[model samples]
Target: MKAMILAAGLGTRLRPLTLDRPKPLVDVHGRPLIEYNLLLLRRYGIVDVIINLHHQGDALRAALGSGDTLGVRIVYSPEDPLLDTGGAIKNAASLLGDDDFLVLNGDTIIDLPLDALLAAHRARRAAATLVLRHDPEQQRYGLVEIDGEERIRRFLGRPAEVETALVPYMFAGVHVLSSRVLDYMPDPGTTFSITRATYPAMLAADEGLYGFPFAGFWRVIDTAADLARANAILEERPPLHFL
Candidate 1:
């Protein structure tokens, strides 16, 4: 299996900290944030990794060149004018090849049963399976509504209307995507969001887009406070099995 860490963001929210490095390179308890995701994928035996680079990208490359220290073989996709999620995936289509690959946010920490998520994705034969979790701030983060069968009835605000009594969940920024999804994406080099543009189109066409329910430790290290909170939480009791 292959994986891509969406690490190209300028991370405007992180401010001065990100002024020196990319969001994924920001320190979290003495370790770069992206290192956790790299180690997490390595733990699950997914070693082939692709990282899209933009802001302070050279620094990221300098810090973890070739991914040898991290136990993963990484290739970088350098984007001068950064591509959004969907565009990033499309940009690295050649590296990802023709298989189901994992996509995750570089600035977040999440610990869940990856095997179970993969099993569910295959069982459902979904075109894509996003990791969804209940968050009181679902609307704040963005609402990802799912039906009884776990089909994502709506993503963010896409498909604006739905009669079904959909349950809202927050997108964990992790997902398994089939190679065929590339068909639904814009032309290569185009900037677009997978959730905002691609997924909704797939949903409209009745393509299977499902959600994997996750109830585990998850945090988005976006702001300075978020970074601090993660460190505090981890310091109290190391819950991450990989650590």
Candidate 2:
């Protein structure tokens, strides 16, 4: 299987730490944040990966090299002006191939059953299956509204009408996407967001956009406080299985 780590963000939220390096290279629990995702991908038997680079792109390249140390073959997609999630994935379309592939946020640490997520995606034959979790701050983090059937009905705020009692779920920054989802990608070389652009359109068309609710360990290292919390969590409960 193949996967792509979205590592091209400027990491403005991380401040001075990211001022010197990219978010993917930001240290979390004594290791680069992106490394956790790399290890997770390896555990799932995914050996081929693509990583988008921007905001200290060279540093990220130097840090990860050819992904040899992690046991995965990595090809880089360099964005001159950082493309958002949607554009980044579209930029690497050639490498991702014409099949389902995994996409993970570079700065998140998650230990969910990726194999089961893959199975669910295949069973539903969804255009995109996002990994979501119940978060009290879901609305604050731009909640994803899903129906009882687990189909994603809206993201952030869309449809502008409430028909059913939608459950608020936060995007876990991990998703399994069919190559066909690329069809909804914005024009090449354009900056776009999957959540702000692609997802809403797909939902409007009634495409099979599903969500897998995960009740497991997940964290996004976006700030100093978040980093500290992550370190504390790891200290209390070592991620021996994930690491």
Local distance difference test values of all predictions, in order = 0.88, 0.87
Stretches > 4 Å off in candidate 2: 157-164
C-alpha TM-scores of all predictions: 0.95, 0.94
RMSD of each: 1.9, 2.1
Lowest lDDT 10-residue stretch of candidate 1: 157-166
| Predicted structure 1: lDDT | 0.88
What's the residue-level lDDT of 1 in candidate 2?
74
Model 1, residue 243: displacement in angstroms?
1.8
User: Which pairs in model 2 have colliding backbones?
Assistant: none
Top-lDDT structure, candidate number: 1
Error of 1 at 45 (Å): 0.6
- Over 39-78, each residue of candidate 2 has an lDDT whose tens digit, in order, gives 8889878979999998999999998899999898899999
lDDT of 1 by residue, 1-243 (tens): 999999999999899899998889888877889988998899989999999999999999999999998889999999878889999999999999999999998988988778889999999999999998887555546468888899987776533333446567878899999999999987889999888899989999999999898988888987888889989987886658876
TM-score of 2: 0.94
Q: What does the lDDT come to for candidate 2?
A: 0.87
